[model samples]
Target: MASSSSLLSEEQFLCPICLDVFTRPVSTPCGHNFCMSCITSYWDNASFSQCPVCKEQFQRRPDLKVNTFISELASQLVSLQTSYCDHSRVLVLFCRDDNTLLCDVCSSSCHARHNVVPVQRAYERMKDELENTEAKVQQMIQERFHKVQSMTESVKQTAERQADGFVSDMQREIKELQRTAVKLRELKQTTDQLRFLQSYSSTSLLPHTMDLSTVSANKHLEMQHFGKSLRKSASQLRVSLDEMNTEISRFSGGTAESDAATLRYMQQYEVNIVLDPDSAHPMLCLSNDGKQVRYNMGAGMWAGQFLNPNMFTSHLAVLGRRGFSSGRFYFEVCTGQKTEWCVGVATASIQRRGPLVRSSCCGLWAIWFLIDKFETFICPGVPVHMGKVGRVGVFVDYDKGEISFYDVENATPIYSFTECSFTEELFPYFNPCDNEFGSNLEPLTIVPVCHVE
Candidate 1:
C-alpha cells in the first residue's frame, strides 16, 4: 500500500508537457506544476496565459519560481531507478573491447582484461563528434540553398534576354513588312495614273508590266542581311558554349592522356581475333591458339600442299574469323621480332585464289614490314620511317573512315589512312611473309590488350 502511494507521488512531479521527470520544476500563478523550460516554451507559443489542465485564466503573466523540493525528489527517483548492476552501483566506467557501460561489478567480471575508460570521457567524445556532424550538415544545407538561388537568378536573366531578342526580331520584321507595303502602294498609284492617262490618250507612256525587280532586289538584300546576322549570333553562341565546356573539363578530369591513356581506355573493347586457316595460304602455318602465324619453309619442298580454292595462292596471308562492318575496334600485333610481315584490315570480297593486288582499290589497307623500314600499301607505296618499333597497335574507326597504326612500345603514332570508303565487311589480315632462307622466320604474334592497372 505504501509503495503504490509513492508511485502516484512520483507521477505528480513529472512534467505534463514532456511526460518526463522535471529537471527544474516550477509553479505557475494558477498553482499548476511543470518544468521551467517546458512552461516557458508553452507560454511563449500560447495566445494567452492560462492553466493548461483547468483553463483558468491569469490576469497577467506571473514569474515562475523553481520548486526546489520537487527537483530533489525527481533526482533521487531517477538515480535509484537507473543505478547499474541491479541498482546497487552507478555506471561510471565504459569497456572499450565489450563496447558496454560498466559499473564496478561489471568491470571486475567480464571486462577484467579489457581496456576500460571513464563513462564521462566516452560521453564527451561522442558529444564532440555529434556536434561536428551537425555543423557540417548545416553548412551543406546552406551551400545548396545558395546554389538554388543562383540558378534561379540565372534562369530569370536568360528568360529576360531571350524575350528582348524576340521583341527586336519582331520589330525588324514589322519594319520590313511596312517597307514592302509602301512599295506596293506606290506601284498601285502609278498603275492607276497610267490607266487614266491611257483612257483619254492612246500613247505608250508606261511599260506593259510593272518593273518590281528593284523592289525584289531590295527585299533579297534584307533577307541576306538577316541571315548573316543569325549566322553570326549562332557562331558566337557556339564559341561561348565551347568555352564553358572547357571550363567544366578543368574542374572535372581533363581528356585522356594523348596516346598512352587512350590506348588503355580502348583496351576495354579488345577483341579475340582468331586466324582462319581456310583463308590462310599453303605456305603460312597458324598456331594452335590461332593468335599467331608463321611462314613454313616446307611449302617450297612440297610445292603443292593442299589444293583448296579458298587458300591464298600468291599472297602468304590469312584472314581473321571475326569481321567488322561498322563502329570502332582495335588490336595489337608483335611485329618487332619479325623482319617481314603485313598487318591490316581487308575487305571480304578480296580475291582469295588468283594473284592478289595489295592496293587500296584492291580492298587491302595494310602496313608492309620489310627488313629495315615500314611501307604502307596505297598504290605507289609510301615509305614510313618511324624507327624500329616492336609492337604495333591498329585502331579502326569504320564510321569515321579512319585506320590508324601506332608503335605501342614507344607510344608513337606510325601512320593513319583517312577518308576510306569501305563497301564490305573488313577482316583482320595477317601475313608473316615467306621465310627468306630462315632469315625472316620469326612468327607474328597477336598480343591481347588487357587492363594494366
Candidate 2:
C-alpha cells in the first residue's frame, strides 16, 4: 500500500475544481474526489449540482463529508513533496539570500552566514509578494483597457459628427440641384422666346450646374478621407493594445514583438510620390521617372524655360504631382550624404514666385538639415536634435492636422507638427538646398516603402 501510494502522481492528489492539492478531500456520489470547500463553492455558483470533472448531474445536492483516506493521502503527498531536500534531509528553513529551500545540515553549513527564515514564514511572505505583484498587474491592465475604450469612443464620436456634417452638406447641395432642375424645366417650357432668354439670363447657372465629374471626385475624396480617418483611429487603437501587450509580456517573461509595429502601421499609408516637373524651380532638375530631384549645376542655363505659376522660382525646390486635401499619406526620401536638404509637405497654393518663407505660417511644414543642424520650418525654425540619418520619412494626417517626420533608417521619430490647420491641398515638397560647390550635390530620391513583417 505504501509502494502504491508512492506511485501516485501529484495530479491524482489535486482537486479538479481548484486545480490544487486537495484540502479536506471529499468523495462525491459519482466517485470523484474534490476538496470539500471547492466542490461546495462550485455547486453554489452553478445552477445545478454536478461533478465538475465528469459533468454528471445529481437531483439533490449531496451532503459533503471529508473522505479521511483521500484527505490523508493528499496531505502526505504535499508533505512528501516539500519536506525534503535533494540530499534527503528534512527542510526546516529557507535561505533568503539564495532564495532556496534548505535542510538543517545545509542551512548550518552552506547558508550559515545568510539571512534565513522559517520555511512557513518565507512561504507566506513570498506568496504575499506574488499576490501583490499580480494585483498591480491586473490593475494596470484594467486602467489601460479603460483608456483604450475611452479613446475608441472618442474617435467614434468625432467620426459620427464629421459624417453627420458631410451628409447635411450633401443633402443641402442635392436640394439646391433639385430646385435648379425644376427652374430649368420651367424656363424650357416658356411660350415666349424673350421670356425664356430673360429667365435664363437672370438666373446664374454657375452655382446650379451640377458637374457629374466634379461631384464624383468630391464624393470619392470625402469617402477616402472618412475611410483614412477610421483607419488611423484603428491604428491608434492597435498601438495602444500593442503597448499593453508589451507590458504584459514583460511581466510574463516574454519578448515584445511590437517594437516595429508603429513604423509598419505608418508604412501601410505610404503613397506613390513623384516630383512635379511643372512645379520645379529652373535651378532644380527632376529625374525622368519623377522620383528624384537635384539642384542643377548650370542654374542660369534655363533662361527661356516656360515659367509655371506654381513653380518655385526663388527656392531650389519642387512639389510632388500627387496632392492630398484629406486623409493620411506617407512617403520616404533618401537624403543620403546630403549636407543641405529640406523635405516635407506644403500647401499646393504656397507662394511659388520670389523668395518664399519656409515656415508653417507661410503654408510649409518641413524640416531643413544643414551640416549637422536640423530644424523644423516653424516661423523661427525650431531645432530638432537626432542622430545622423540617411533616409527620411514624412507622414501626414491631413484631417488630424498633423505632419510627422521620422528617421527611416533607425525607425525613430525626428519631429512632428501637431494641431496644424490645413485648408488647402498639400503636396510633398523637397528642396535639395543649393549645391554649394558640389558639397550637397546628392539628389533627394523618393523610395518605395518596405513594410516590416
Candidate 3:
C-alpha cells in the first residue's frame, strides 16, 4: 500500500486554465476542476460559455460554486509538496546547523548530528517569531494612521479659523458701510444749506466713508493669504499621506502570506510584451511573433543583418518593443531548462553600445541566473537562494519605484529592487546569456499571462 502523499501528484490538482494549483477550485458541468476565478475570467472574455477542457458548449453560463472537497485535497497536496525532500520522502526533521528541512534519509546520511530537531519544534519557534514581527508592523501602521488623523484635524481647525476671521472682517466692513450710507442720507435731507455744506466738508464724515478701492485691495490680500495657507497645509497633508502609503506598500509587499495570492494579484497588471528585433544584438535571433529570443552562435558571420542605433552591440541582450513610464506592469518569461539567463526592466536611456554596466546606477535592474547560482545584477551582485526556478515573473510598480521578480513555478519571490528613481521609460529587458559550449542554447520565450483572478 502506498501512502496518501505518494498516491497524489501536483498535476492532478492543477487548474487546466491557469496551469497552476487550484485556487478556489470549482467543478465544471463537464466534470473538470478549474480555478473558479480562472474559468470565470475565461467566460468573461469569451463570446460563449464552454468547458475549456471538454469544449462542451452551454446555452447559458453555468453558475460556479467552490468545490470544497477538491479545494481541501489541493491544499493538502500543496502542503505535502512543500514538505517533501528531494528523495520524495516527507521531511520530519529540521537541521539547525544547515538551516534546512530533512527527510529520514537526509537526516541519517548528510545532516547527521547537525543540531537536528523535530520539524514541529522549529515550526513553532519560527511561528512565534513571525507573529511578533507581525504585531510590530501592525503597531507601526496604526501609529502612522493616528498621526495622519491628528494632522488632518489640525489642518481642518486652521482652515475653519481662517474662514471665521474672514467672515468677521466682512461683517465689520458691512456695518461700517451701512453707517456711512445713513450719514450721507441725513446730510442730503438737511433743510439748512449751511448745515449741509458744513456736514459735507467735515473731515469726520468724509473720513468715515469707506474707500471702495482700498477695501477691495484689503479683501484681495486677505484672500490671497488664506489661499496660500490652505495650499501649504494641503501640501503638507499630501506629503504625510504619501509617506504613509509608501510604508503600507512596503510592509504588504514583503509579508504577503501566499505566493499564489501574490502572483494572482500581480497577474492583474500583466502586459503583452514582445521582443524588439531592431534593438537585438547582431548575434541574437528573435522569433516571428517577437515572443521568443535566443543567441545564434553563427549569426555573427552574417553581414546582411541590419544594426539599428539602439541595438545592443556588445551584450547578448534584447529589449521589448514597448516601454512603461508609469503605473504597474508585469510580464513573464519561460527560461525552460536554460542554465543561464537574465530578465528585468532597463531604463530607456541605458548605454547599449558597450559592455553593459548591469546595475541600478547604470539604469539596469535585473536578476541573473547561472548554472547553480541566482543573483541580481547590482554592482556587487546579491545572491538569490530560490531553488530551481523554471519560469520567471517580472513585476514593476513604476510609480512606487519597485521591481520584483518571482519564481512562477513555486510562486515564490526571487528578489526586489526598491526605492529606485526612474527618470525615463523602462523597457522589458532580456539576456539569453552566452551559449557556453551549447549548454545554454535554449530560447527565452515570453508566454502569455494566464491571469488568475
Candidate 4:
C-alpha cells in the first residue's frame, strides 16, 4: 500500500532551479535556481562565467526574472508538510548528519541514519517572516498608486492655472484698450480746447505774464496769469496724453503667453546677457531712429551703481535702424568684459496689462490705440505687470496722469513700477524715426518670455 505521506513528500517541493518538484535538480545556465535574478546579476559583471548547468560560455549576461510564484508555492507546500505528520502533539526533527531538518518524527525516520532533533523550536523562531514579506508587497503597491494619482491631479491643476492666467491677461488687456479709446476722446477734447487757446495765446496772456521760475514761488500771482499758463499747461497735457497713448498702443498689440511648461531648472529659459569690449561684445551705439529703448549720452547728472562717463545707455525707437529689425524689436544696450548687463522685460509682454501697470504707476491705465507704441515708464518702487510675450497691447493710467508699457493687442502691461522723476522729454522722443540719434552698438535685448504664437 502506498504511504499517505509518500506522494506528499515526493511531489510537494520543487527545485529552487528547474521550478518543478525536485527531479534531478541539476544546475542551470546560471548557478542559481530556475529563478535566475541572483546568478544573472552575479555573472553579468564577471568577465567570463560558465553556466552552472551545462557550463556554457556567454559573452554577455541577459536579464533574468525569478519565477517567484513557483518558488513560493513549493515553499508553502514544504511548510505545510513540515507540520502535517501525526507523530506527536508538537513535532520537530533535525538531521544532524547533513545539518538538515524535518518537521516530524516520520520525516526523520524516513531519512533515518541521520541524527534528528525537534523542529517546533526552529519554526517558532521565524513564524512572522512570511506574513511580513506579504505585507510589504501590499504596501509597495499602495505607494505606487498614490504617486500616480497625485501626479495626474497636480498636472491638471497646473494646466488650469496657466489657462486662467492667460484669460485674465486677455480681459485686462481689452479693458485697457477701451480706456485708451476713452482717453483719446478726452485728449482730443482737451487738445481742441487748448489748441484754440494756443492760437490766441498772445491775446489771452497779453494782459498778464510771469516767468515759470517766478510762478514756482508765487502761487497766487501765477494763478492770476492763467492765460499764459493755459498754453503751457496744454502743451504739458499733450505730452502726458501722448505718453499714455504710446503705452496703450504698445500693450494693445502683444502676443499670448506660452503653454504651461514645467521648468525644472533655470537653465531652460534664463539667459545671461553679458558685455565684453573684446570678442564681439554688444555695444551701446547710437540708434539713428527712435521708438525703442536705446543707448544715448546722459545729458544730465544721474547717479547709480552704473555711472560710466561715456557709457550709460538709452533706447532706440526707430523702425529700421542699422541695429534694429524693420518690425521686430531688439536691444541696443551694453555688455562689459564678461559682465552681465541685461534689459529684458521684467516679465512677459504678450498679454494686455494696461490696467495692471496703470494700477501700479497711477491707476486708470488704458491702451488708447492699436499696435501700442507708447513708451510708458514705471515709477520707482512700483511692481512690473506680468504677461505673455510677442502679443501687441498697451496700458494707460488716465486718472494718475501716467502711462505704462503693455502689449497693445492682448492688453498685458509690460511695465509696472512707480517713476516720480520721468519728465516729458522721456516720453515718445518724436517716434525717433524722423530724427536720428544714439548709437546702436548693443540694441534693446528682447528675450522672449512666452511662446511667440
By TM-score, the best candidate is: 3
Per-residue lDDT for 256 in model 4?
Answer: 28
What is the Cα root-mean-square deviation between model 3 and the actual structure? Answer: 28.4
- Location of the lowest summed lDDT over 10 successive residues in candidate 4: 258-267
- lDDT at 62, model 2: 79
Clashing pairs in 2: none
lDDT of 1: 0.62
Q: Candidate 3, residue 102: CA error in Å?
A: 42
Task: Point out where model 2 deviates above 4 Å.
Answer: 1-259, 301-303, 379-381
Clashing pairs in 1: none
Instruction: Give Cα distance to truth, residue 99, candidate 1, Å.
Output: 40
Each prediction's whole-model lDDT (CA): 0.62, 0.67, 0.69, 0.32
Model 3: lDDT of residue 63:
62
Better of 2 and 3 by TM-score: 3
Could you tell me how far off, in angstroms, the CA of residue 148 lies in candidate 4 after the best superposition? 70
Candidate 4, residues 213-304: lDDT per residue as tens digits? 32122222222333333333334444444454444333322322211111111113222232221111112333333222334334333344
lDDT of 1 by residue, 185-285 (tens): 22222222212221211122121322222222122232223443433444444343333322221122222223444455445557888999888987788
What is the model-wide C-alpha lDDT for candidate 2?
0.67
Error of 1 at 14 (Å): 78
